[model samples]
Target: SLVKTGTGELTLSGDNTYSGGTTISDGTLIAASVNALGSGDIDNSGVLKVGEGELKNTLFGSGSLVKTGTGVLTLSGDNTYSGGTTISDGTL
Candidate 1:
């Protein structure tokens, strides 16, 4: 799923499977599940909030992230998303 560039927020809860990948270009995207952000790398140029659970990816294909915001963002996962994090601003 995609959160288009604007003033919107995407909230995810419970188990989900939409592996097309997520891209936040101009808003907030909240992940409440380990798989909430899917098994793909998140290309976030906005805010990402992890409220509960973890955001993880398969070992076979390591997860990745890109963060850019001043808001507090946390990844409390037993994260295998090892594609490397590039944070221009905010916390990982």
Candidate 2:
């Protein structure tokens, strides 16, 4: 499992394959690639930023998702996150 905390930004850019899931308790987690978050469940209690790619993870939490940067950030999965999503600067 991956747990992101603190008050900074974390960027995920690799085509990850971890199935243990992800948990964001604070700060921001930027998905910089299509498969950056891998295929797992996401529990975000902070900020989830999608820069320019596609995310296919199942999200569920009480945080917020912000779309930033240029290009398109496509959400192409069964996302169950009970958080607010905002388009800050770019296309979501």
Candidate 3:
């Protein structure tokens, strides 16, 4: 199951499961860090902004994954991209 908390923070604890596609629109997800714990495939279609954390596993983005602050974007597996990525004004 998927769980969401208040606007202060959102956390998905424990081993989560998904049979179909999961979509998260305009929002912020703050865990101890951002961990994509799965051996399956992750198809990112929207804008995903990672704050301060590590992004484990493959991240397939159709849109973009913007990172602000002193955060790190970590990919443990393979990442497939169908769209383009741009870094402007020292921003990524």
Q: Which candidate number would show the highest TM-score if scored against the true structure?
A: 2
Give the Å error, residue 47, model 2: 0.3
53, model 2: CA deviation in Å?
A: 2.5
Q: lDDT, candidate 1, residue 16?
A: 68
**Ranking under lDDT, best-scoring first?**
2, 1, 3
Give per-residue CA lDDT, model 2, range 35-85, as digits (tens). 677767889999988777767777889989888787788888787778899
**Residue-level lDDT tens digits of model 1 in 1-92:** 54447878767766667776666676666665445666665665666655433445422123335454464555643444335556656555
The lDDT per prediction is 0.55, 0.83, 0.44
TM-score of each: 0.52, 0.82, 0.47
lDDT for position 1 in model 1: 58
lDDT of 3 by residue, 1-92 (tens): 23222334344444444433333332434333354332344455544444434455455757465554454545455768464543322222
Q: Considering lDDT, which of the candidate structures 1 and 3 is the better prediction for this target? A: 1
